[model samples]
Target chain A: MNHEKNIIELKNITVRFDGETVLDNLNLTIRDGEFVTLLGSSGCGKTTTLRIIAGFLEPDEGEVFFDSKNMNGVPAHKREVNTIFQRYALFPHYNVYDNVAYGLKVRHVPKDEIRERVMEMLRLVNLEGFAKRSVAKLSGGQQQRVAIARALVLKPKVLLLDEPLSALDAKLRKDMQVELRNIQQATGITFIFVTHDQEEALSMSDTVVVMNEGRVQQIGAPEDIYNEPQNAFVADFIGESNILDGIMKEDFTAQFSGHTFRCVDRGFAPGEAVDIVVRPEDVDIVKPEDGMLKGTVTSVTFLGVHYEIIVDIGGFKWMIQTTDYAGVGETVGLSIDPDAIHVMKKSKYSGLYGDYSTFSDEMEEMNQMSEELAEEYAEELAAERTEEAGDGAEEAGK
Target chain B: MKNRTFLRRIIGAPYVLWAAIFIVIPLLIVVYYSFTGPDGSFTLDNMKNLSDYGQIFKISILYSIAATVISLILAYPFAYVMSRKKEKTQQIMMVLVMLPMWMSLLILTYSWMNILERQGIINTLLGKLGHAPLNLIGTPAAVIFGMVYNYIPYMILPIYSVMSKIDPSVLEAAEDLGSGSFSKLYRVILPLSMPGVVSGITMVFVPSVSTFYISQKLGDGKILLVGDVIERQIQAQNNYNMGAALSLVLMVLIVLSLALMKLFAGESDENLYV
Candidate 1:
């Protein structure tokens, strides 16, 4: 958080495109050797933030700093930063080695040094023997690794990755997530990764910057972001949360579900409204007589490691994930320990998201979006190889 | 989907019949006529006459190659600029490119004739500038200009389409890797658009070499391209046998161009479409 330790700083960065504000006076500081993720859904200014840092998109009303230098007018090439584009964007005609060596060649490095660096980078990505292979012939994950290799071969001060794993399959996405985190740690270079995947943000990043609607909701450590979301959107976006309307009666006591419960969060005036969030994994089901609240099981789904069960209590649905299963229509008692109860000041979107609907809705939307992005990229790759000409605008029939 | 399959097969029947009747049969008849004499008897006379048109063939290739090179030099930047423009501007440029192609080739050449003549637009404009009118009409330059003008759109369309489809991120990727503007263009944009460049060359070269009207009007019989010789053989000379032989030579030229396209874009039918 100190200026001396920050590798990149965006000072009141604002970007507008065709009269629409994409980034509205956003400020963020990334520490040296830190892996920070800009976590947000679509149209949330995450990619725009990454581009401004890479010096590809200049902010309309603010200055960007790299190592305490003004980077407002610096072109992308002049900046000591590199970006792994969303779709890899590898040179289709170049082999893996040439693609990775392109930067060295541009910098006029010696042939021997270029070869050694390229080989080292390829080996780093575990593609040592694949230097001669055409990138067009590579699989999705292989191309992604090639992209990373190409960006990191320069040994830049900062590396910006824009949803680099969105094109891979589920299993490969998980594998690359771990591989990427390990690579970043090994290199010890500052990384600015942008993704809409909450699980990826939580698992991979040292610091997570939660964003929504072109504004920074909160920026903190991954655990801090998960445990203490600043508002309703952060609680909703980070993970599955059972958010309920509650009233703060007094210090450390909150009223919800037609009953009073103890909560650790305070500072709100007495008799004031608040939003309470309880993570699905934290809520435990207990015996009816010894439970905090009694509810009836509405639905149960087996999710391999855990069973996702929804319970209806006081006319509100609550999602609970546990190893134990609950049959539908069975009466179940739920207990939220004092620490599991989180209180947030209600914002404009208070009580807008239901517990049962938000989880599946978020999952479905993200899965669908991930698939669509992959499919479009696949089509673009096919188009690249086969060169689909526009219309039948030529006299040559063939 | 199942119901549409039957109807689709039915819809395709007409194209099958048309190819068999028009394309396949005509090609077979040309092959038969190439081997026969005026009396419809098998002879080697037409093959023997192939040497008579050798110089014309040489001239055709030279002029078309020169025209195709010039067109490439002129169209590359134009197409690149068009590709970088807004969607509305691209549409307008496309309309302008296709406008010249829609008119009959003969009319276009005649219009060029009007411009390149001794007392025509260029000369009249030069006379107004107090300079002597230069001779361009009935020269190789006039014929080459005609070919370049008519075939310019052929080169522009494929290149523009390919350039516009290039992911903007690829260019940014090149820039991010410390490439200058020239390096980005020479390394990335040019290599990725090679398929379009190949198709454009083939499209322009084949038609430019085989067009008789432009040479006849602009060359005015002073410069005899192979197409004009073939026309004279068939119409002015009444030598069908010799014309068919020369026509076969032109066919070889077209087939060779197609083969060159195949060599450069050996990837798929989608690339071959351009």
Candidate 2:
């Protein structure tokens, strides 16, 4: 909550690889003891930004300032920052104790002090008696704790975590999210996390910076980002939204889906083209005769807490999530409050999302399946390389 | 299920037969000859005669150890450099390392002889450069040089393979934790690559200790090794008993050294073999 001064600043940063721009004219600043997340999809340059901050990468054109001092030409080892890699790159040869003590040993800290600090960090991460355990023998979650302890033992000014929990199961990931937030608050170290999971970002980050295609779409608190997205991409990416093309009639008024509605957004030119965002949970289901806009329910799915119904209104599908039961082929009406309707200026991402016409549960499942398959393929490739190396060793032995 | 098991056994019959014929039978024959006399009776004479060639044994052990150490020192840095290159460059460098192995060992040793002989290419070049012609061949150094040059690829391959498999992120993590380049290598890279180093030493030392061709040509027959003596006893002197005895001793020595290495490597022995 302390927004007094900037701990780190990146100005006009541009990075190009193989003649392709990965980050373009990007600028960002982080405050001390803040938990900021850079959220985006794959190839959206979130990891690249984290790497730039970690000093593993250098921007082609940019100025990086740490504590208000220009940090150009500083190597990663000379900086006061540490990174937790995606795979928890612990030294396989070292046990948990040695891994945590590596930094202290490299600095030639006193042995007794090193042991005390290492044990203290282990206690912080809840790995007290696991100092002698081999890293490979530990479970994924345990290894994650060791990696955290290793980096935080150095007491870095800033901790950069690049999707540290992405490899864990869903339930464990949720637990770690809360644990990570507690750790950040307890230690009061600046944490700059990078992840592609929007839900993870929204739940954990004090400030979420939504990114798309090498550009910052929006930056705000989680509630503000979810409720009042500045653009169509931010609205669609943050959660499910019913985005429709609309015209701003005047201040506090908008027209969409052949009906004018009252909204809280304003300051737009008269009759300006815009995008209107309607959250699925904000719409109320009513009888068709007493409703504002009437529609026929096309599909209904029970989602544990609510029933998600897709309604067809004037040939456009609108998703509504409510506890009310709406059967398919039944006529229904939707009621929208003025505060529930969010309006924004038109962006390049307009019309690219926010439609449920081609959406299905199977399609979402298929997307998850493909991601799992890609992960499996990468693991298989690594196994194959290890086998090849084994074969090479045998041949050399012969 | 029974039928599939039968089929699997049938498919594996050839390898079993090949091992019994080529490997197992030959070893048994060596063991037999090692303990028998010329009259086909058991005797301890052959084992006792080994003490007479103590000098040859010492020379062979010393030269091979020297060769193995030199190869390791030269190949570690080279393999480390090669492993850090881009993929395309790494492949090219790997191919270059293996290209010399495709030729015959005798041919390679002959080539080294031509390069190191008194009036060969190196001496000729030195003479033309207005320097006195140094004694380039028929020395212990030339024999060690030949052994190193011929077997260095074995040392490089395993080390390079293991080094290349080291996750780049681990090195980055080391740097992130405030380790300089030297500390990173000494603490992280070297310890991780120990399996490769142990295997490389084994691969280089085994053949160098038992090699006959390099010492014969490069040593000018003056610096005889255990292999040369075994070869002379079997082919020229027709003394298979003494030859088998010497061969058995060499095998025992190699196995002992390998066991020592595995012990030193500790838990990393899981990765010592394929």
Best by lDDT: 2
Q: Which residues of candidate 2, in runs, are more than 4 Å off?
A: A360-398, B1-17, B268-274
- Please tell me what DockQ candidate 2 reaches: 0.39
Candidate 1, residues B136-252, lDDT tens digits: the string is 889999999999999999999999988898888889999999987899999888877877788889889988998899998898668898888888888998877777877886897
Residues B55-103 of candidate 2: C-alpha lDDT, one tens digit per residue: 9999999999999999999999999999999999999999999999999
Residue A391, model 1, lDDT:
36
TM-score, first chain, each model: 0.87, 0.90
What DockQ results for candidate 1?
0.33
lDDT of 2 by residue, A123-184 (tens): 99999999998888889999999999999999999999999999999999999999999999
In candidate 1, stretches whose alpha carbon ends up further than 4 angstroms from where it belongs are A1-4, A323-327, A330-332, A357-398, B1-55, B122-136, B253-274
User: Model 1 Cα displacement at A327 (Å)?
Assistant: 4.3
Provide the clash count, candidate 2. 0
The stretch of ten residues in a row with the least summed lDDT in candidate 1 chain A is A387-396
**Candidate with best DockQ:** 2
CAPRI-style docking class of model 1 based on DockQ: acceptable
Q: Over the stretch A118-208, how does candidate 1's per-residue lDDT look in tens digits?
A: 9999999999999998787789999999999999999998999999999899999999999999988898988899999999999999999
* Chain A TM-score (model 1): 0.87
